[model samples]
Target: MRHQIASVDADHTSYLYEWKLNGRWNKLGATVNSDFVPMKPGSAEEFILEHYWAITGEAMLTRWNTRWSMCHGV
Candidate 1:
């Protein structure tokens, strides 16, 4: 699987990302899971993120990074 960061919000609260699967983009769909809160400076927030991939009538789960780094310049 391959992915690219499509976009990120100005406050870095939301990230728009996309993934390529089976030679296509967003074929299985993508999910962005988080608390949906802005990060504080020099601090980390608790986040629950997961990515679901559908393959051959089965669902496969992929965990995202629990810690999201605050963007220095957005």
Candidate 2:
């Protein structure tokens, strides 16, 4: 499995991806400006997404654990 981080700049959006390789998260590839305004998926090229830490502490922890396990093939 892999992990991805999404961020927005002005009117543009970007996604950065990483893979857990050798116990370390390493940079992979990214997609940018692949959507239209008001937020509709556009065809620019690339893949992405997931929300950030806006949930409860426990929920955040659970999310991380789940992702960690998936990355490790656990």
Candidate 3:
């Protein structure tokens, strides 16, 4: 319920007075070197990429009234 959002500087420190809130104090004045590169998780990427396929399969199964039982190895 924040009426106004405070901006953070390049150092990642919020202008709000509570620096220790949500571990902000620990991450303050930190820097990421040039070697820092971002990449997506493989499982997440696969799930996101195959979302349409999952939906299509569900639609097809529903239309055909197919029943599926999945096996989980204990």
Give me the candidate number with maximum lDDT: 2
Error of 2 at 1 (Å): 3.2
lDDT by residue for model 2 (1-74), tens: 55556655554444445666677776544444434433223322111122433443333322110112122312
Q: Write the per-residue lDDT of candidate 1 for residues 1-74, one digit (tens) a residue.
A: 33345334433233334455565545222334543444433332212121222232111232332434332212
- Can you list the residue pairs that collide in candidate 2? none
Which residue pairs in candidate 1 collide? Answer: none
TM-score on alpha carbons, each prediction: 0.20, 0.31, 0.18
* lDDT values for all models: 0.34, 0.38, 0.31
The root-mean-square deviation over C-alpha atoms between each candidate and the true structure, in angstroms, is 14.2, 12.3, 18.2
Ranking by TM-score: 2, 1, 3
Which residue pairs collide, candidate 3? none
List, residue by residue over 1-74, the lDDT tens digit for candidate 3.
12222334442322212134453332222222223233334554345445655643433322221123322221
Instruction: Give lDDT: candidate 1, residue 31.
Output: 35
TM-score for model 2? 0.31
**TM-score for model 1?**
0.20
